[model samples]
Structure formats: C-alpha cells, structure tokens
Target: MTETFITIFLVFMILAAVVALEARELLSTVIAVGAVGFMLSVIFLFLRAPDIAIVQIVVEILTLVILVRATISRDTHFFEDEREFFPFAINIVMIMVFLIFAFWAVKTLPRFGLNFSKVAPYYLTKGLAQTGAANIVTSVILDYRAYDTLGEATVLFTAVLGAVALLRRKAKAAENKNG
Candidate 1:
C-alpha cells in the first residue's frame, strides 16, 4: 500500500516537472514546480515522516508565494529556443542514465521492517533507559538523533526567516509609496 502511494506520487511529481520544463509562461512553470513540491510532501507523509512533510509543505508554500509574486511584478517572458539535435540527443541520454540509476538504487533499498543499520538494535534496546523516555520513537528522535533534529529545526527556522524578510520588504515598499 505504501509502495503504491509512493509510486503514484512519484509519477505525479514527474509529470509536474515535465510540465514545468515545457511551460511557456513563467507563472505556469512556477505553479508546476509548486505542484511537484507539494506532491513530494504528500509522499513524505506516506513514508511516515510527518516532520519532514510539515517542513516540505511550509517551504513549498513560501517558495510558491515568492515565485508567483516575482512573476507578477516583473516583465518575465519564457522564450523557448529551437532545440538543436545534438542537445536534444544529449538530454535523452542523460535521462536514460538517470532512469537506470534510479532503478538500481530502488533495487538496493532494504525491505520494509528490516533494519540495515548497525545502530538500530542498540537504539531499540537502550534508547528507553538512556533517554528515560516512555515512547521509543520520542527517545530515539530526541536523544539519539538530536543533531539531525537540530539540523531540521534550523532549516525550518531559516525558511521562516526568509519569508519574514520578504514580507517586511514588501511592507516597507508600501510604506515608502504612501510616505
């Protein structure tokens, strides 16, 4: 079931990316890119990573807003050039290589419920005692993987800061216009 959902999301993301690439309008391309990001967030949820999903969605929304605003404010035009035969052939070969690499990586993924990490057994056994957390998940996330959690928090903070800065700049511009 999880695999099915992931596959579906991946397909949608790919379609969105292709749409973005082919789009003639700047807004259309931005919208298509936003779709890909939102779909990726959904896939993260299906993978049981709610924290990652939350961050992904927040960043995606902020990015879309900024991109759309820029598209509207500036005189942006997407001019598609005639594709040369050599460049088109190179792109096709690169895509094929990417597909082959993706297939190989998927095949190498560990089976669900199987832990490939050497630290997993230790964490499962000692996480509770070491962290004194009742929930194993909480203990592992807060105690064992504190650094990783901190990194994620930093990323979220940076995204919020960027959004605040953008908003503040817009407000100042409005105030200057009024003054």
Candidate 2:
C-alpha cells in the first residue's frame, strides 16, 4: 500500500513540477507548483514523517494564498508568452544540467529504504523521555529542532508582510487611477 501510494504521488509530483516549469500562464504555474507541493506532502506522509508533511502543507497553503492574492489584484486579460530570444538553447542547457545532477545522485546515493541514520532510533527511544512529548516526531521538531521551526515561521511572516505590502500598493495604484 505504501509503495503504491509512493509511486502514484511521485509520478504526480514529477508531472506537477514539469507543468509548473512549462506553463505559460502565471496562474497555471502557481497551481502546478501547489499541486507539486501537495504531492510532496503526501509523499512525506507515506514516508512516516507527518511533521515534515504538516509543515509542507502549511507552507504550500501560505504560498498559494499569496499567489492568489497577487493574481486577483492584477489584470488577468491575456496569457503571457514568456519565451526568450534563445529559449531553445537555454532549455537544452537546463535539461542537460538536470540530467547530469540526476545521474550523479543515482550513482552516489544509497538505495531507498535503507536506514540512513542512527538518530531515528535515538529519537524514538529517548525523545518522549527527554522532551515530555508523546509523539517522537513532535519531540524532534518542537524540542530538538525548535530553532529551525522558528526560522521557518519568521520567513513565512516576512512573506506574508511582503504580500500585504504589494497588495496595498496595487490598491493604491488603482485608487489613484480612478480618483
């Protein structure tokens, strides 16, 4: 069951990523990116990492909300053609670079499902005892890695502030045009 879910979500993630990159419309790109994020969160859930999944979902929601706000405030008349003068050359180069990195990763990384750390055991065994959290994942994220969580929250707050500022600017510009 897990393997099937993993396979399906992985395929969706790859498709979403590709569509996100290739989409000509800004809204389509944003939707594709959100789809990718959702698939990734599901993948993380299938891997038994609910903490990461929750964080990914929250971040994805925040990002989609920002994108939606930005899009709604703008004129949505025509689809944008983002083609460049040398689009083919750039696309080829990017594909080659990605393939090289993919091959390198395949060669260097250990096989999937391998226990890559001794930390998991330690977290499971001593986490609740040390942190007083029943869930080991919670203990790891909230107790052992609280600083990382704080940093993420700070970044999200900053992003929200930026989005609000941009929306305000757009509203002011519209008011100036009408008034």
Q: Candidate 1 at 63: error in angstroms? A: 1.1
Error of 1 at 9 (Å): 1.3
Looking at model 2, which ten-residue stretch has the lowest summed lDDT?
76-85
Model 1 residue 62 distance off true place after TM-score fit, in angstroms: 1.1
1-179, model 2: which lDDT tens digit per residue? Answer: 78888998888889989998787677888899999999899899889888789989999999999997797688753456666769878989999999999998898887778878888888988897899989877687789999998998999899999989887757887888999
Residue clash pairs of candidate 1: none
Backbone clashes, each candidate:
0, 0
Among all candidates shown, the one with the greatest TM-score: 2
| All candidates: TM-score | 0.70, 0.72
| Candidate number achieving the greatest lDDT relative to the actual structure | 1
Candidate 1: where are CA atoms >4 Å away? 98-106, 132-179
Model 1, span 3-107: residue lDDT tens: 988888999999999999898988999999999999999988898878778989999999999999999999988867876899899999999999999999988
